[model samples]
Target: MNDTSTTPEAGAAGSVRPTLAAVARLAGVSNSTASLAFSGTGPVSDATRERVLSAAKELNYAGPDPRARSLRRGRSGIVGVVMEERVGDAFRDPIKIALLDGISDEIAVIDAGLLILTDAGEAAQRIEDAPMDAVVLIGCSPRLDESVAMLRQRGIPLVAIEGDPADDVLTIAQDNREATRVAAQHLADLGHTDVSVVTLSLTRDRARGPLTDERLAAGSSNTTLERLSGVRDVFPDAGGYVTRGSFVEEGRIAGHALLDDPDDRPTAIIAQSDLLAAGVIRAAEEVGLAVPADLSVVGFDGVRVDGLWPYDLTTLVQPAIDKGRAAGVAIVEMLEGGVAHPATFTSVFHLGNTTAAPRAH
Candidate 1:
């Protein structure tokens, strides 16, 4: 048998990959001219471009190396999207999908790619070492302040979507407190005093149980704390269940725990997310309780839930996509040596059939 893979001039790979310099030499042009021909960023004659392309094809060269171009530009052409949860968990929410769509739309203008990083799980290492020109923190928690500090020290432009306000970070904030307050007040006006809440994970531990004073104090998520505060503002001492994530299953568990109590049951339940509200409605049905009549359910984030029809969930319609766009624009401005002012957006109240006055007992 004859072993055939090695060449005298080539390393173990059989044939050394051609470089731009080799292509330039073969094309009889300067390295810079060859680069400009391929990049189209500078003035290059049609004849020069053709020569470079021919040379590249002959040597099986794939134009300029992205690593070298990134080195020359001193940028990775990557924008990091930092999430507090796993990427899979984030993608499960419709609101997050819309937000990502908006972010992608704006970043495409600059020919930048997104790098999704999570503070938890295996993706956590990337949060500290990834080469990103800028980073957008979505639903950041206080525990990640160290990560933010490190990113700031590295001079990476930072933007936050509903994150805790920092000194230099540009934030795209939402009216979580005000929106929930309005939703709660709507329930208040419906002649229902016994109202409960199904909250998003208050802390990173994600302990699923009733909300206690210690748990409330230990809550790290800014959005959850703000929304919970809003609910308390209306129904002081109104207790509720804390969920593990923003999933419908968590909502169903909470709904069962809250509604199954024979001694005391809330006439209305305020879910932190629309999906949670839908789950709460499902749980209501499982217990033979009709929505709006036996129980009124209200949700935040105007997301369309499948199988949630005929119950146009009463919710605070938030501009999730606009918020993402604002964050992307802020990132671009910061990268270009411009200041991006912190922006706060309000949610509109959408009256839906999911909520109604509690039935007379």
Candidate 2:
């Protein structure tokens, strides 16, 4: 008989998978000691740790199964990130991408995986039933009160970005009202009395049309409402067109409608998003109007637009990544049995070439 034939093959298809118990037995240690050596949560002697690792290698034991560890800790080690819009649509925005990057960076440290859930199609049910340790709701609407209630019932730690869904949830709020107010006032100082606005969606229905008094009263999105109010603070009667989303095409549609009437066209336009601003710019060019010379346009959210050179967009530079990181830190604190407080971030005005005094006819 060959001695090599008698030796157990490590990780062979037919070989039995080694367990922590077998590793501990080979290392002459208790099961608890082996667990501590792997988890690093409890103290273990250096010599013992080395012995356990050496034994685990010989036995082909890959420490403990993550599933079993999660079960033992009573946590799934997964964080659910819920968005109000479809994942595909949400990903198109640079702000959303930067926010997600910040969130992923913070959560990676705790060995928690992210499970993205959107409140659309069949995935909406996951908002209430997902096996996650905590959840972060990004750009959620006040209309999601029922969903928030369900998540709360399930005992999931909740953090909301820029929405007031509930009083108990840790909120990472933005200074939407003040920032837009400042932007509007900038145009006002430049003698732009005939200014119009291009707004984001006001309701879940995403009805695109003029922002009527009735529609403004029934607005469900906190961000849209806040920014709208900010514009109203400067231009009380500044009428605007509501869009389905913060999309360029929607802004272009709004721009054409607002600019079609040359006699009644606004001297300036305040777009709620940078993408919308870019569309408004394109619409101006389509009508043979030069930016800042014939029409002055201002936008919010200082996101870099590809192919938008020769025009530095004058917008409010909000701390998008920092907002996401704040939310992530809040989630970590809550999950670690610590209290987390709500955070509010403000935006800085970035002066660029897109804005100037309205051209005299």
Candidate 3:
């Protein structure tokens, strides 16, 4: 049962010998038998294994050491994921969850593990020392540079998902700008010149409210700026409200502000993400406005939101899961000493019920 009565020996100066050896000694078996008793790697008689385990509990041994195993393999078996936002915040979004699920699916086939590293204070420091064979940057944000530099210095293989096409690192890209352009052109074709835009956060601060012109112009995130440019391609004069996070609440806030004043309200609205489009939809509904009837809205990212309100959201669906899987595959390839070409993907336009011809005032 419990080996609380066993005494531990001084292993090597500061370190103490674990209870494994003691368990073997007490059980009157060889040290290798004791190891097998704990590791379950080899056959051990029922009576012999039970005694070894009993001695372990008395000695307070937590079990086989992870550090020792990692050192032996020269690998941590952990894939570091560097995200632009806080770790908790990143996981909170369904988009991030789905992408991570895809990554997990791939890594599971290889028996690897995922480790999340946020671009925060001490956690940033850990990036340099943490044992990881490879790393994947979730998005291209200015905040990622320092971490990327650390990973590179360690000679770690790096893969960036939905990030810039950098020289040293492998990239998995989406047609963010081009896809947005396609979305914008759809509205333009519908004769909606009075179109306005609701955009995602341009910086890590991600202030959860309306975005000012200065912030929009100064955004450090590549995707935000690129998507905004896509909108401008069709409506050069169309102005917009920037949102801090891509959450539905942020979209709702932006939508309310853009649609509040009838005199200034645009005939159409373009949201950078599907969640934002849904928020714009909610805002319109709150004001007793009709979709495509009173106000038209179009969104990007064709991610199927379960139980959508009405007309399917007119948006561009990018392969977010594929983007993640590509990054994981590239990291594994690089770690295995193989060269992998960067992956670039384009988005497809889905004309849903949320967008249509602008209503005559």
Candidate 4:
């Protein structure tokens, strides 16, 4: 049975889609010849190639089946990028966007595609069963151990960006602790002892509120903990609010909480990110306080903040794109059976007009 049965819907609705073997049979060629003709990878005569293509056109065949091709190759050609945040929320941050771009640029060499995945909600199921040749974990997700256990069971290559290092996993790290230490030290040198910090989410649930001792103890966000350690290195007793996410609005909320009381306001604020620093600036304006004049603010990540005019932020500028590219390259190398080493990046301090000596109260 050649499956040549035809129905009334064959003309407009497209016949049950002709297979490559069917095209080969109609072209009077072998199955391998038909494949070679389509792929142009074998030494098929031009006339024979033309005939095979003509038969394919007559039968309305698009090409060889991709699923079949992957089956033969034993690779799904998909690289999973696992993030802890929602896809929509992840793209809102320019840092995430830049990191993704870098990963895409390197993975193109293998002709592989990216499958954006998360470790929460409905997408969690995909983390366990989705077909992936390799995975790149982004940020420090509290569920990292569980994700690693499943992916390791599948024997997929793993590369983590800014994640806590584990056995057989490569981590692309940045100088969060050291960079923030330098930034905080700058404030300390300027005699700004009365300082507070605005930190990123420190728990899996991203609980928002004052950063209490209990919350600090239960924190698992590696990046947040590292940056906080850096701040503590300078101002050991510094305290402030913790945000649910890395957004300007969250920073505004934290800023208000820390700056509302004029009598007990700190002379300086160290925000975990530039966006948060921008929001803190807005909060200061709302409270009729001047930056560097009334309070000095420092930020991390050297990203461009929109509408932050007349004030160059005194912050740590990290190589976000480079970090991403390194992770991508490592993933590519590992997939090719080569050893990939862990990488650490440093952040440079940019002296901007945002920080100055505090005024006498």
Candidate 5:
């Protein structure tokens, strides 16, 4: 008995994956007919489909390649979402989740899926080579110039969520400075003269520590810088810790560092994110300091924080999901040969139970 298997023979150059055209040729059918039979989208006869399947089995053909199909259609049906943080970190943050949901909501109209990519480490390669119809940047990354340049070189449509990217990229702007200013003014009106700020990442490194002069000068994160400027407008001497990311744990760390010292601690702390603010509140509790009584804490990004039952956090409620949807809509419009203008969103200040007048020492 002789073996008739189609395995690659020894001494042969690299084995080529069998193509659908070869299957069609063996089945005695045209390429289009073979494709229709595999996809089950056209009017191919059962007999013809059976023949095509049999030929495919014999040739070890797995069906039409998605890459080839995309090439033929001149569209990948993929929307790439690029962020500066790890994929896990991005999901951990609720604001990030909201933005993603918004983008998904709008892109669903075109039957497209999302491919999340990061600017650091291994995922950087995908940012340059992924087959994306368009891209949405999550925030102002320190490596924005490099990522934008590479994507633009590939001629992919670009949309930024809050980054100050190049002029060509359509930015979905948020009023970070104005909103933070409102929160700061609220603290000021309440007579919070000794105020401090807990900021987000100041650079792509996402380093955690006190905000030194050098760090402030080298800051590249647009959201952090903008919010910092807003707070400074009211409290010129405001200074606080720089967190690694928008996690409650990071905020707690900043909170401990600030609240540990009673003599030098500020009366109020303005956190860049709600999660951070929650952490600050926790730290205040740890040190026997009650929020709005001993320490006034203000947070941004009016997201619902779990386990925050007792305190209503005063914050700036920005339209996170709406911002994401706008970006997705812009990407779809650009892909369909329509113009997509840049969009700006405002944040409304919510008076919660977290902030109050300082008590005399």
Candidate 6:
């Protein structure tokens, strides 16, 4: 407010850098006195404090770094996100991106950074070693046991989204089995007597091959298993092809493998991801088939698509982003010693443009 006291150099640099001495000199006091005025850790008249702040403004100075205050408070002020996928890929997916955004909002109250810990394309072993005040597992990663063990051992707070066996870990859960079962029943109701599935992979090995019962029994990803169980609940004999990840390419590959042989093909297909469903749709086109008319397609994770063809995906619209944000809140609460337990989230069924009755032909 004091134009006469203000110097033009304050705006010259990109950022204002006012020293304690500068604030003190302007306030007509010693540097220590100015420091005391700013910190309030030492006694200072209210009027003196106001004067020092005014001098800081005349020099266009921002108050002391919050980082310094946080450091002195003995808080690491960091929340770690442990995802098995690449950061770029994770951000690209709308579901994961939304979740991260939500988590950021929750962590803001604590003034914490969301540190992303990727195994650098490694496995669960590396997940444990990340420097974090707490850990949130983003999606269904392959190394749950090792990852969980490490986090628990270090006494780092932990939360998982769609993790296995419904353990005591803080989790945002989904009705994966029940949700997929709804989708499967929809297909069966459509008179899809012979239906098959395109499933997300069960292991980190990520092999592109037909799914075997043995592997299914030992499957690690809880989401994958629950979805598979849902399918089996309807068409007990339904066949499926499992791939390494929940990407479009994997769905396309699984789609081609499942749909290429017309004589043996099922009239309906359930892909566990929107990307995979898109891929499966692509595979159908390459074989000269019409969506819903020749083949009915359904996918999970009600996501949006721009360049996808033929139809909007029929799917279960799970709140992926909300799940991530909830995990962040849980972690922060646990770290702050406020909350004492984990969280579980659920998904809803969303019917879109992708499913139809099997052609009587």
Which candidate's lDDT is highest? 5
TM-scores, all candidates, are 0.81, 0.81, 0.79, 0.81, 0.81, 0.76
| Pairs of colliding residues, candidate 5 | none
- Model 3 scores a TM of 0.79
lDDT for each residue of candidate 2 in 31-52, tens digit (9 for 90 to 100): 4456556755334689999998
In model 6, where is the ten-residue run with the lowest total lDDT?
3-12
Which runs in model 1 stand beyond 4 Å of their true positions? 1-68
Which portions of model 4 show Cα errors greater than 4 Å? 1-69
- Scored by lDDT, model 6 comes in at 0.73
> Which of candidates 2 and 6 is the stronger one according to TM-score?
2
Displacement of residue 207 (Cα, Å) in model 6 is 1.2
Off by over 4 Å in 3: 1-69, 208-211
Model 4 TM-score on a 0 to 1 scale: 0.81
Candidate 1 residue 140 Cα shift, in angstroms, is 0.7
lDDT of every predicted structure (CA atoms): 0.82, 0.82, 0.73, 0.82, 0.84, 0.73
**Residues 152-179, model 1: lDDT tens digits:** 8998988999967476678899999999
lDDT tens digits, residue span 1-361, model 5? 7433334321134375665556656788754456556655344689999999998788776664447649777887677888888877886888887887688667655546567788887778878998788899988564668878988999999999997788778899999999999999999899889999899999888898998889999888989999999999999888899999899999999999998988889999999999999999999999999888999999999999998879999999999999988998899899889989898999999999999999887
Candidate 1 — worst ten consecutive residues by lDDT sum?
3-12
- Residue 238 of model 3 has an lDDT of 74
lDDT of 6 by residue, 188-217 (tens): 887888988888778656566887888777
Give the C-alpha miss distance for residue 304 in model 2, angstroms: 0.6
